[model samples]
Target: MPRIRKNPTGVDPQLLVKDAAKLMPAPTRRLFLRGGASLGALAFLTGCDIVDSASAEHVLMKISYFNDRAQAWLFNPNKLAPTYPDSAVRRPFPFNAYYPEEDAPEVDKEDYKLEVGGMVDNKKSWTLDELYALPQETQITRLICVEGWSAIGKWTGTPLREFLRRVGADTRAKYVWFRCAEGYSTSIDMPTALHPQTQMTFKFDGEILPRKYGFPMKVRMPTKLGFKNPKHVMEMAVTDKYLGGYWEDQGYNWFSGI
Candidate 1:
């Protein structure tokens, strides 16, 4: 069976191109078009959309034509499509080739429970049962990515703030550090870290957070870049120093926001 699709989000390329073109002079626009065509054809050949971002801008514009006709072009939505009541959000087609590999969160999920440690009076590991026993919260929120796509979905889980409060975040605690199953990790500030909309999601669209979609848990923040939403979270640490994120180290903005 095919892996079920999950978490679709992206930006409207044509609109992005249009916006980009409007910024450049007419002569520059022509150059960008030819370059875009060459890049687009290469992407088609290589099965890569970002083979050349500078050149593919025009091609993305052309793709946007069909996407627009499909009424699926995304950026900021004037209105979101009716939530499926349908369950199972389809994963967006990824055009970039930076696929990161990690151990699946499902195989030994309980084997690596979330450890709450650092600058805390009570350092502990939380089991699924323990997290479930906390007062649960459900919310429908939009996932906006730095690449420009957006999607809305339902999430149910314990609020990060609530979890920290329950575990007793110390006065010195200024950041929440998240360590994932892949040995990958990231951190967030206190405010965004504890945002009302942020959650250690248990369910997506009324179902478990599937393996491909970060089974055990992932961070969901309304105010930051999607990359900040790390997956397969297994550890939460309250700290003071700036624990820069994976993407941030790669020249991407740490404060990736709208």
Candidate 2:
């Protein structure tokens, strides 16, 4: 008779599965669960032994990368996130950031210049007036956060695809990266960047974007989780390199889509 292999590290296999599952998106988690949560299966998937906590964590990280790929493959650029009417717009949209509202970076509109670089024909830096002069559009969309809360707000800005075209960006590039004045940075896939709804937002609710909401500009991607929407953007680059984001480096899934 074959003997069962007991966990040598005393860490409950079920607990390890639970921890890893928590980091996955709902649909992926359900699929994972349906596939079976056995430690042997996880070991097979990660190609590592589940003999210790460290190995267990490595397995989880591998699963996270798997989740990222799965979500990216399943994403549909043509599918638009739902939009709301003016009456549904949340009054006093809640302020959110890693820092306090008072600490939001105060950018001077006159001196601010958005530096553009990487895989583009036009590498020129753009001033506030130049950006604002571009044709703009508005959409009332919900900002869904990973922290379990959501808010609908009106955002007005230039479609990122049009802006990319105007800048002579290589549409075939793999990623579009953004750097913010507040030391926050993130990158998104080219497909999402070219999505019609993804905009370089300059105004919120028919007024200049408040300092609390990223004064000069913000990238409003209703298709992604709130944190994926970078605020106080100062620089942008089109690249094939995989430059990880602040949260993404901390183990959050890179291809986080709603």
Candidate 3:
């Protein structure tokens, strides 16, 4: 996504609300919008087990009401998990590129290409259709952003392991690193790469990724934090050695386990 000056969700309250919100249960909505009614009830029920009832109540209520009622949610148990109920996570159709403004970068070609190489025998560049031609896998995953909000999304794409195998990756390829268009990057171990649910994701919410979410292509690390999911992916390489990824060099742990 281009770095637009205005807020991406939009300035209009209704439009902003629509873009950010996932439809949640009516009671949960009421409890949240009505401000402390439901939160108070939950606190009363769980207070005995909590460290400090008053402090706990403040935190619980805060998560649900903290942000614009849409955009994303939280449910970090280590923190206060603000979850969107399962029903709210339903996908109506595929996601699309969300350009923040009219001047955002336009995808110019039909064959957006991806380069797969490094420590593999069959280094090659694949066009969008070529990638789609590969065996595809689909999974619903949780998009956990670092800012403390999350959303569950259904994604369809080819498995990275499949790609590795096709490219003839050496057994010693212990980790994979990605370079994305957003000037952001991430890396993961081979074990995480081979996990059944992982993907070299192509489609999201049944649609292509939005720019703010990394249009064209983005890495989706379901069991990991959002920063690990690099958007606007350009290249990937398998390595036996640990070359610290983009985030790691900045101060984050290379092994950012979820």
Candidates in order have lDDT scores of: 0.61, 0.84, 0.59
Clashing pairs in 1: 10-148, 10-149, 11-148, 11-149
Q: What's the CA error at residue 11 for candidate 2, in Å?
A: 37
Best model number under TM-score: 2
Which sections of candidate 2 miss by over 4 Å? Answer: 1-52
lDDT string for model 2 (61-146, tens) is 79988998888898898999998889999989999776556656778787889999999999999999999999999999999988
Would you give me the overall lDDT of model 1?
A: 0.61
Which tens-of-lDDT digit does each residue in 26-61 have in candidate 1? 345334344557767887988987654555655655
- Sort all candidates by TM-score, best to worst: 2, 1, 3
- Candidates 2 and 3 compared: the better one by lDDT is 2
CA lDDT for candidate 3: 0.59
Q: For model 2, give the 10-residue run with minimal summed lDDT.
A: 1-10
Candidate 1, superposed: residue stretches over 4 Å from native:
1-107
Q: What is candidate 3's TM-score against the reference?
A: 0.59
How high is each candidate's TM-score? 0.61, 0.80, 0.59
**Cα distance off (Å), candidate 3, residue 140:** 1.4
lDDT of 3 at 186: 71
